[model samples]
Target: MRNFLYGAITSAAIATLTVSTLTVAPALSAERLSLSTWGSPAHYQVAEFVPMFKQLLEEKSDGDIRLKTFEGGEMVKQQFVATAVPQGTIDISLTTLDNWSGRVADVGILTTPLWDKSMEWTRDNLKPGNPVFDYFDAKLRDEGAIIIAMFDIGAPVVSTSFEITGPEAFANMPIRAYSKGSAQVLQTLGAAPTIMGVGDVYSGLQRGTVKGAMGGLGGAVGLKHYEVTSNMFVPNGVMGTLIHAYVMNKAKFEGMSPENQKILMEAAAEARDHMQQVAIDQLASLLDTVRENGNTVTIVEPGSPTWEAFAKQLEPLAREATQSYPQEVQDLIAAD
Candidate 1:
């Protein structure tokens, strides 16, 4: 009986050792992820957040997961992220919802000039438990992708060769439009809107093909749009925020262990907060960069005669574009 008890204990110890070996063997080999972004290396999306997220993920996972980054369309074009990520051409991609707006109508709402809330308001309202965010998650999941985080790209301004002091000043000027909603807004203000990518705006403005371009403060400075434009018209609260989302392939995300999944998500939230705060903190400096580059900055006061006229025309145009959303979604978005 003593020998039999000793034999049983030995077998139990061997079984436990084997189970431990099986559980830890996979972790010894790192899982390599191909992470891509459309932004240039210096852009905050790539510069500030991507590295931080990668580091956090790898460290927390003890090098079990590794992120290999592709910056500035290295893996694919900016607009192809949605398809690429799901097809496994890339594991993750950072881009704005506007890139896939053609596939998801609600995605375009992020780019529409209808956002009147502050960044803090937007952050709070779109948190995990919020219906607004839940709606977005459902919409994205249908596309075989998941949004890890969303960020504000700051408000865009009209940088024009001529001054836009009032609605009348917009007459007949050819402005570069970044989105269809923006095009309608410009048209309502009597400006001829030409559609083009932000990257093309510098050359378009420089070559006199377009008199002005709608762009974010950071983009104008980063892309050097100030070199060609003479004026920056910050049209009060009417100027909408350019929000960006960090998206990952849903299947890939689901394939990870719950701990790694949580690690990735937590890192994303931190990166989102860090990026937005950095952008907000750098707004003054970005505007100063514009001025130093020889562009005059004009802030149109809210509710002023000029502001009222622009808002009156723009609000209806924006609403019409986003009318497809349920009333609740619209109300939630438009609400304070």
Candidate 2:
């Protein structure tokens, strides 16, 4: 009886070890893909996104493909990720489209009020099919990049050294804005809008070149701008914008085995969902951090007379900026 028990124990141990080895094993063919993005290591997207992708990709590829990441300036300047990916200098880049607006005009459609509520709208309309992805997939494919997964960075809010309590306040300040919405939103408030790079915003604020800016919470913290200019004006008309992308070089993506490609896509789609949840959670934390640092937070009420008045004033620019997309896309979102 004792001998029988010993034999059973030995068998169970071997089975457990076999399973462990299989679970942790790497693929026979190992390939490392390098990814780059314009975010500093401290950037929320990078901190939350990079490791999640690496782990998911590794598990999906069953260890066959490993992602190597180069962040901050080493991979090329942060804003250059989209530009570099086309050249194949970097296999993939996590990017913000606002920076690439010059190259792809419709890309900014989401950045403006046209798609302000698009997070819910797009998911409601196009998740299973992802037509926007289809549209952009083709657009990006032509540039030698493929969009596999994406998420919103959270709505961008305008933070400033100056307070913009009313239209006049908004106007007198030649606001440094991010994408087309920034231009439209600030312009409606009666301010001159200048498209400014993320890196340039700090200097612009400090030197009084820009009295204020429209940006997100993470951006203000990451750039250390709160240290200089400390008021946050949160507007209801799309204070946030979506961000995050996991893309691959066209040639590299196509080179993957069909089975591996499917595996990668599945993982990426799941990651996209994870990213969206993270953004929503982080937004509150980011706001708390701003206040803890001694900055004032002003909530811009949605659909108030002030908001509607601003929108009415800037409707023309909004319409022109949103022309490339279906008018309904903007109207449904703008309607509220």
Candidate 3:
């Protein structure tokens, strides 16, 4: 009887331990996600959006979800983030629509100077049910990534070693183009456009390989283009805006619980709104900084003669660029 009782006790203890281990295993296991972006730690997407996303997700998930972030091209370069996210190399990524343009031609519509809308206009129109947003979102989804949020980096500006007093200034000027749309714009303006990466632009300007570089004002300041270039032309709503989209791997996103997916979407929208306002404020301040640094900053007011002249010059190119897109998209641009 004593031996039988001892054996029974040992079996009970084993069962209890197994049950305890099973109960605690799930509690200890958390889903760790990796996010990558090309922006440096100082970039607004890094400084503002990333932390907001991490905090919201961790808190909402009750620590079940965690994020490992790579910034400043640590995991993948900016141009490759679109591919990396879908290929499962990255769980989430932030990249410009221009990077995805080669695969999804419809996205190139936004990169062109066709839309003379202000930042506010763009923001108001980029919501669900909006034809433009739905179109691009569907196109990206077909490519295996889902856009969680969209925000403007800033308005496109040209920083050159020489002053841009008039359209004539761009004649025969060699400038670095960040996208094919920008290249078309530059070429149409009689400027020689050289395709270049953002990282090489400062050096390109410094070495006189490119006399001017087309980019956002924030990028010019963040990358310290002021040190290498002398003038910045803010085309006010003339050159269109630079927009960045935050995306997630579609398979991973679909695999999440609906509640978690909702939480991610909410967090992304909050972060995007916060970043947009901060970007506006930062752009204004950075413009003042550029002026204070003894660099000439020119603003082409939307209705000014210079603006009208530029609008006229680029209208033909804009129409041509939108030819491949759907009629609804072309109408949207024409209406905008």
Candidate 4:
């Protein structure tokens, strides 16, 4: 009887320990952060950059932090992410500077015609310590978010039903513009600019509501714009590059432990750098896809006569658009 009682007590003690561990383990598990992105799952930033950031952050944090992502505007629309982050609708999100232009006009500097620089030049100049970045970051902070990383989608390209050899091709043409800056560019070229969502451009093209669309090559491939548009004008940097930033809610970011904050920023920077190269390679692949689809691809080399003339035509408009910014910002952006 004594031996049996001792065995029963040991079994009970073992069961209690197991139950305690199961309950306590969950309490010690990694803290989860929520991130929402407007890109579809197939988008490079969704498929590549976000995953890379998640892995790097988790590894760097030693599993102390985990991310939960909502892609394809599941939580907030692309245009609203800038506002949503500040309202704490999402802890983190990706936003284009142009989208923030309504709230912060200085961000429009990046979208101005004066910003016609190569991807390499952009990568070098639009980084953490740069004057442009500092100026924009301060503005964004006042609106309640912090920029962790900034990257380009690619050089801007335009797809049209008609052929485009030079700026004159845009004359009186109806083109879909994704933002006010893009609309301004199209208008300067004498085209009728209609601002629309990225998803709506495909249907708009099919319905003949718009004759051309301004965006990146990756967008052309992803949306299969080549099916409806016969010509793709790759003026490379003449139209300026599209910029997107990964941002975190200011309160959430500030509330984090300094160690975790450092990890998040480091991971974001690493992911941004890696994805910028991916964007370049992806653009090349996407161009091939456009060609394979039997579309004419026009390469307007930067500094060529046509590109130079296009730049000169846009110079006055660029000056007017940037007049609101500080002279230092205007000089810095306009500088070679």
Global lDDT of each candidate: 0.76, 0.69, 0.81, 0.82
Q: Write the per-residue lDDT of candidate 3 for residues 67-140, one digit (tens) a residue.
A: 89987778877778778988889999888888787888777777777655566765666755666677778888
The number of the candidate with the highest lDDT is 4
What shift in Å separates residue 27 of candidate 1 from its native position after superposition? 7.5
Candidate 1 per-residue lDDT, tens place, 1-336, comes to 999999999999999999999998877666777888763467776778888888888888888888888876778665577678667788888766666666677766665565666766655555566666677777888888888887776667888899887888889989988766567667888899987765578889999999989866666777777878898988745756677778888999998889888888888888777877787788788788888888898987777888887777677667675676567667767664
Off by over 4 Å in 4: 1-29, 334-336
Could you arrange the candidates by lDDT from highest to lowest? 4, 3, 1, 2
lDDT of predicted model 3 = 0.81
Compose the digit string of candidate 2's lDDT tens values, residues 104-125: 5556676655666544544334
TM-score of each: 0.85, 0.80, 0.89, 0.91
TM-score rank order: 4, 3, 1, 2
Error of 4 at 12 (Å): 3.5
Candidate 3: where are CA atoms >4 Å away? 1-28, 332-336
Output the better candidate (3/4) by lDDT.
4
lDDT of 4 by residue, 68-155 (tens): 9998778877778778999999999977778888888777777777666666665666778877677778888999998888878877
- The residue pairs found clashing in candidate 1 are none
